[model samples]
Target: MGANFISLSLTFAYLAQSFLFDTQVYPDVVQYQLAIEGQNHTIHLEKNRDLIGKDFTETHYTKDGKRVTTSTHE
Candidate 1:
């Protein structure tokens, strides 16, 4: 019983570590859409090319070629 418990604990720890630290799960661009007040809003997270590493650009836009807001983060 002790051996089985140790084995299970090791397996759980391995899985948790992989899930918490894995970088490959992230992508270059992610997008989401929402409807509020009968208008469509699109939010985007894109990898920034101007920076050296891992920076992101966030942009929000409407359906009719109108930009609502934009921001950048590292």
Candidate 2:
């Protein structure tokens, strides 16, 4: 059964690699999409770049979320 063992090990290794690179899929965006065990999620977040660090503005009565109207160095 050595062939079966090798196949199973390879499958497990692939899964582990996928998990480690979960954050790699999201770049230059404030949110991420992830799926696990048939459950999915869209996580909201704010990231700092070279130009500005953790800077954002939110206005009042803005029903829309993540609607960036103003930015730094404008």
Candidate 3:
């Protein structure tokens, strides 16, 4: 029973460390905004130049009484 408890604790610790420090599992996201013809557009993507001007999906949200717009690459 003691050995099993120790193994379970180690497994949990490994999972916690992976969740806290693994960058690939939680990639960095950047937000960009563009304005054209008096209209505003917002997108969320990685900081890569090659990804610009690609197809994406737009999402809208409301937080703290303000509308938020975000986009994800398709």
Candidate 4:
């Protein structure tokens, strides 16, 4: 049982590390747009990153569904 536990723990740790590496090394490009009501009301967004690839963009819509806001991380 102890040997099995150690093997399972090692496998889990390796998998987690691999997942983190992939996400950090290969950042995903996300392009999203949304619109509601009116003829020309829309929100268009494209995420941009710096040299280190740490910047991220997030968009949020209000509960009333009348406004949209965007935020960035560094």
Among these predicted structures, which one has the highest TM-score? 1
Which prediction has the highest lDDT against the true structure? 1
Candidate 2 lDDT at 15 equals 50
The digit string of per-residue lDDT tens for model 4 on 1-74 reads 33322111111223555677675553233323333332333333333545333355566767878666454553
Reference-based lDDT, residue 58, model 1? 64
When 1 and 4 are scored with lDDT, the better candidate is 1
Clash tally for model 3: 0
Task: Estimate candidate 4's RMSD in Å.
Answer: 19.3
Give candidate 2's TM-score: 0.24
- TM-score of model number 3: 0.25
lDDT of 2 at 48: 52
Instruction: Supply candidate 1's per-residue lDDT for 54.
Output: 41
Candidate 2 global lDDT: 0.47
Q: By descending TM-score, how would the candidates be arranged?
A: 1, 3, 2, 4
lDDT per residue as tens, model 3, 4-36: 211111112235566687876444554456564
